[model samples]
Target: MMDLLRSLLFVLLFYPGTLLYVLTVIIVSPIGDAPVQAVVHAWSQFHHWLVRNVLGIRIVWDGAIPDGPFLIAVKHQSMMEAVDTLHFAQCPVVVMKRELTVIPLFGWVTRRYGVIGVDREAGASALRTMMAEARAAVSGGRPVIIFPEGTRVPYGTSPPLRPGFAGLYRALGLPVVPVAHDVGRLWHRGFVKRSGTVHFKVGDVIPPGLKRDDVESRVHAAINALTP
Candidate 1:
């Protein structure tokens, strides 16, 4: 019961407090995309403080965030992975669900910061459009981050990734950095939070070749290999 109460307190207090702390970020974020991006990055770091103190979750990185301007395939677990990525990489262009683009404050800010949205239901055609946008974003000097799994999965359960990652891989034709992590262990929905460490493993960048048009399976394998 104490654990549950603490968990509830952590969840309820964090959001409003976070917004209050970064009110300036929300207001000035609209000044320009880069300024907004910079604030969001700074906010993510601040967010780490909230998560660390309130939820008592620790994040530890075993490898390195590769040099930017490449399409990086990341395995998304729970919500923590989404929030934590800000501290892990140079503000890469995030591949997010189309629905998220409609949110009030975050949506507007993310759009300003150049997030690429995808409608998963539109199938292959949607993926092509997203890839094109990703290419343009990369050219603008930002790396693209995709959760190859396409959706969040529960701890220890692997969900099949949408094939969009393969399409992106071939279309972009840049080096791909595969990132894996143990985020769900500490941050899964309904799980009581306590003091613990989350491990993130950044693997070598897999440079592309002309003959291949798919790398989803390889990316999945690489990420899963890092799981405990």
Candidate 2:
């Protein structure tokens, strides 16, 4: 009923909104990366507004966003949070699968945005390549955001993180900021975006140099600590 209408409205509006932002990106691309990112940030902001006003969805941030260059290991539940990161992070270099880079305009602009794309099936060599790119991104003083689970997990379920997360942590030697959120409840992995507040709870910064097992255990617990 209403859910279907809201969902349909969300889908209809999204196409135009994305097109508008893509046009902005094209117009500002000649100016440089910073301006282009500003355009993307504006789009994310608009998305937030649409979610709040049109879809009756709200986003609440419950913890501090770390300062300086670091790695952000996020709980991947929905695309909403991914869009939100464009606004939340100072300047983020997202580590994504190589497949996403072929997504028409999204792929083209994200490459221009300097996102690191990796072929996940490539094994150790891919890990090395990912770390190298992430290192370069952080070197520029921007944060790197990675989905620990490597893909979206359904709401209320926690999955073991992929090895790449630990690999990057060890290779980069930077504090890992674990960000947890229950966005799946609202912006589902399927469709049917529900109406409610999505809470982004940032946990304590996990210091670098921990053993792989320790790092994974700590981050896994910290991210899933959010209640209500």
Most lDDT-accurate candidate: 2
| Backbone clash pairs in model 1 (N, Cα, C under 3 Å; residues 3+ apart or in different chains), count | 0
Residue-by-residue lDDT tens digits, candidate 2, 1-228? 676788889888987989888877988899998898888788888887778887888778888887788888888888787777776678788888889878888788778888888888899998999999998888888899998888878889888989999999999998989988888887886668788787888999999999999999999987777633
What lDDT, from 0 to 1, does candidate 2 have? 0.84
List per-prediction Cα lDDT, in the order shown.
Answer: 0.75, 0.84
Worst 10 residues of 2 by lDDT: 219-228
The per-residue C-alpha lDDT of model 2 at residue 218 equals 93
